[model samples]
Target: MLLDTHMHTHFSGDSNADPAAMARSAIEKNLAGICITDHLDYDYPDEPDLFTIDFPQYEKGIRQLQADFSDSLNINFGIELGLQPHLAKKHHEILQEMDFDFVIGSSHVVHGLDPYYPAYYEGRSEHAAYLEYFESILENIAAFHEFDVYGHIDYVVRYGPEKNKNYSYDKYKDVIDEILRQLIAHGKGIELNMAGFKYGLGHPNPTEEILHRYRELGGEIITIGADGHAPDQIAWDFDKVPQLLKAAGFDYFTVFTKRKPEFLPV
Candidate 1:
């Protein structure tokens, strides 16, 4: 059974797609289930509340969908948290309060700047910028261990000036390996975000090399996500994910129910 583990709806500040419509679209694509991991990027550079959604309202809305679609598909409530070293306490508190089925920890900001904008790359070389991003991820996960998985381990590549043109896993294998190892040590996993393909990067986030490395280090809790914000984008390129995971030595993919991972054959 294929399940998309990351997505957003109207609740997320950056997205306005209705969750019910997103779920219906997933069913149309023949997906078994999907987890609605909406954005919750606390302390966003200029807008601290930009990605933060009303959890009470969001949870209620998702449960209603789960009931409405109970016979058609499984809908899991989840959240995507933007992690920074300084907000450890805040993140911990939020996680404790929510009843999320899955949590995706991501590094959307580093040193008070988001790499999505060109200014983040204005003076720094791609290598330096990418390295800093990887370092931030490691620090955030190490500081707060509340999330179930890390989202888009290679997110910076999607926005770099060259956009994956000169990026390679070999360039920063040491730090990348460290980050993977840390996640493994904390019993956390990573997601293969298909948004990289949508971004025209010719591959998914973390790429094949990092996926293989994670497996090589005994990390097995791997999930797949389209990172879609709109109905049309749900499960985008998912048809290719199974083969991709097999090449990385994975025979199964993961889903969460009530915060516990359930493995399904790929």
Candidate 2:
């Protein structure tokens, strides 16, 4: 059975699908469960505070879906927090008041600039920008202990100016290794995000090389996610997931219920 731990509903500014629609899709796919990890990107200046979902309302929606599909599917309430070193305090304060089943820590900005915007990389080399992104993850590792897993480790590669053709783990092993070491030491796991496949990259977010290195470094806890924002994207390419996990030397994958992880064989 597959459990999709990263998903977004209408509560997220970029998506308009509600919790019920998301749950119905998971049911149709016959997934073991789905976690609604709505976007909580705190530092996006263009987005109003009201654009973010109220925790209470978000939780209530999930509960309603859980009850409505009681016998058919399991739904979890989660958040995908975009953490920046400068906003640690604010992020922590927001997290403290919520009851989330899973939390995914992600870096959407580096050096106070979001790579999604072309201006952020205008003066920087693609390689330097990539390195800066990885370094930011390393720097923030010590301050972030609120999340269960790291989302889209190589997400910057997607928005990079040079495009996917030039980005490869072999070129950034030094920084990637440090990020993995810190995550392992800090007890945080990485998520194998499948969104890259949809982006026409022919590879998952982190790529296979990074996963192999994570296992070689004694990293055990890993989660697989489609990072889905639409119904058809749920459990996207899940059939190939087990093979990737096994190749990485991982015998199991993880799921979260009530904020606790449950392991299942790969």
Candidate 3:
């Protein structure tokens, strides 16, 4: 089975999952490894609570989970960063100070507001909003190069009002191609976040089409993640992963440890 590279726990502002419980859940699913990628979004707008996280406590939690489940499955300490161009230095500093096995740079908010909220879509067409979101990704990549993989390149579609009904990779390839090229040039990778299926999009985030394009463009590193926030959600829809990659022209997927990647057969 593919290792789940993205997940969250109580340490993250948006989840209440216990680290031990999440570890046990992965063992039950027979997953060989999992990276407990808790949220770390510095300067998130409008949410005073902050997803920056209690680093000391969060590190302590994952360490304990690792000790308890050491023999059962590989539990890696990782983080999911909310990308904002201005916070690049802060993100780099934290990663340098920590011993994270992996880091997923993601854009949960764009231009000071989360697309999950209706206010972000208030006066703009969904198409325009989506374009702006992709553009923001370029700005972020330009500022930060410390992360190992880009999480859900098309995350905006998951919350769009139309919800990808009229979306296609070709529709935005003009910019999406550039995004893919930037990651390739930097030797970075993208993750196949299964939460898209849980969200009823009937496809993984970035979808199969983008995956194929990434491979076709000479990009090789790709990671698979459930983006699970709860025990039951761990590795959700994973059975489709192997074939999904096969259809996208990938014979292998990638996993990270100590900030490095190891390819696994699909």
Candidate 4:
């Protein structure tokens, strides 16, 4: 009974998926649960207000779905915060308002600009741009450690101009190792975002090399997510997850309830 631990719905500014539809899709696929980690990237570059959400209303909606699916599917309340070094305090205020089941702290915008946009890679070589992105994760975690896991440690690769064609974990291991160590020290975990495959990267975010290294470094709390924005995408490429984690030396994966972790066999 694996849970698709990250997804989004209409509550997410970038998505218009029906919450009920998402849950139903999970149940139909025989998943034990799915966590709704909708977008909440405060102070996004151009779209200043697009990624924000109404917390109370958002909680109410997820709670309703949780009750509705209690008999068959498990749904958890979660949010994916776009990590920026400066917005830590603002994000902390929101997390205090609710007891979310999970939180994915991800670096969508590095240096006040999103890597999704071409401009972010325009001024520098892709390698330099990517290196700066990994370095910025340390700054973000230094400012805030409330998140349960860091989502898509290598998300920048997905939108890179060459899209992982020349990317390798060893190419950036020094900073990446520190990033993994920092998360372990702070008691935070990393997510295996399967959305990397959906984005045509032919690999998961953080890739196999990073996953293998995280395990070698004794980081145990790894969560799996599709980073899906809709029903059709939930648990995308999840069939590859169990074997992937196993090869990374993991025999278990993780789930969260009321901010507490519950380990389940993989």
Model 1, span 98-167: residue lDDT tens? 8889999999999889999887887879889989999988889878978999999999999998989999
Q: Report every candidate's CA lDDT.
A: 0.91, 0.84, 0.91, 0.91
Query: lDDT tens digits, residues 163-264, model 2?
Result: 678998989999999989988887878998988888878888889999999999999789889988888888898888998889888989988766688889
lDDT computed for candidate 1: 0.91
On a 0 to 1 TM-score scale, where does candidate 1 land against the true structure?
0.98
Query: What does candidate 4 score on TM?
Result: 0.98
Off by over 4 Å in 4: none
Q: Can you write out model 3's per-residue Cα lDDT over 146-256, one digit (the tens) per residue?
A: 899999999999888989898898889989999999999999999989999999999999889999998999899999999999999999999999999999898999999
Q: What stretches of model 1 exceed 4 Å from their correct place?
A: none
lDDT of 4 by residue, 199-231 (tens): 999999989989999989989899988888888
Query: Judged by TM-score relative to the true structure, which candidate is superior, 2 or 4?
Result: 4
TM-score of each: 0.98, 0.95, 0.98, 0.98
